[model samples]
Target: MVRFSYEGSSERNLKMIITFDLVNTSNSDGRTSLQDESRSGRPNTANNDWNTARVDELIKVDRRVKRKEISLKLDILKTNIYESVYDKLGYRKVSARWVPKMSDEHKRQRVEISQILLHRCQQEGDETVE
Candidate 1:
């Protein structure tokens, strides 16, 4: 029973020491420390480079592959597959299809094409257009 004096220790540090002591005594395992113990099982396997690459390859093979299908095929979670596709590979859903997120260049091209079509339509007049 160590005596913690207010003159020697700050309130916060004393509280922390007492909390640590309580935790150490209450711990079922003999190893009572602040460090994280080595965990078993699959870890963050789905978020690794290998899994990201695998998900990317699957998307390349089939743009319309559902997250559920990818999870089943890769033996990973649907949320993980979605994160890999959207966060890692930069893809998004458009019209029920997975497509690469549009870049500035692609957006400009789309706008240009639309403007050209509009100009042509005006020249021909609404009645002549169709």
Candidate 2:
């Protein structure tokens, strides 16, 4: 079996040619650890086991602490937190700002700004500020 892997500036593609010996069989002699292969291909262990307390702690840190701070405290890579944790938990290592909080503040600010703009427009006849 031959496998060719090509890497480009932006992407990678793989091509494989299976030989007869590489084919799978129902017999135990042909079996291999699929999990091992998958795990080998997966990203390294960084944030696999997380408890509730740890998650909460991470969230707290994400709220106020910087990535460097969190990495220093947790002894993990900032990239791991940003890639794995943020993707899975929807919270960065720092600034785990909640959507609800932002939504409320954004709505309030928009309303206030619109009111101000409308008032200014009414007074000055300029609609561009809104």
Candidate 3:
């Protein structure tokens, strides 16, 4: 079927490419798309999966590891490491330590604690609670 599909040195190469493209295409049952595939602009070099994994490991090893420390250890830019830690790892700085962003449970606990503080302030007076 790929014999005359495209001008290729071998039909095998064209068949493989066509099959790959078909697999990538969504909802295209039997139609061959001539349009060029959309590209995901300039690739991220440092902020890729491999670096993100390394960044995660470093954070796990030391909760208080600074961005500069990671940058030096991984030999990557601090800015790129910052993106991996914050964006990919879902972590944030708290009291000079890197901590994972609060989960739903933590958020619920915070609400309960706030309610308790508010109740104490109302019953025992704000000055006493403070």
Cα lDDT listed for each candidate: 0.82, 0.57, 0.83
Listed per candidate, the RMSD to the true structure in angstroms reads: 11.2, 8.6, 13.6
- Tens digit per residue, CA lDDT, model 1, 8-125: 3665555423313556554756765768779988778779999999999988899888999999999999989888999888999888778999889999999999999898888888
| Tens digits of per-residue lDDT for model 3, 11-122 | 6655433424444453456546656777888866998899899999998999999999999999999889878998889999999888899889999999999999888888
Worst 10 residues of 1 by lDDT: 13-22
> Could you tell me the C-alpha RMSD of candidate 3 in Å?
13.6
List where candidate 3 sits over 4 angstroms from the true fold.
Answer: 1-42, 113-130
Of the two candidates 1 and 2, the one with more favorable lDDT, higher being better, is 1
Q: TM-score-based ranking, best first?
A: 1, 3, 2
Give TM per candidate.
0.56, 0.35, 0.52
Q: What TM-score would you give candidate 1 relative to the actual structure?
A: 0.56
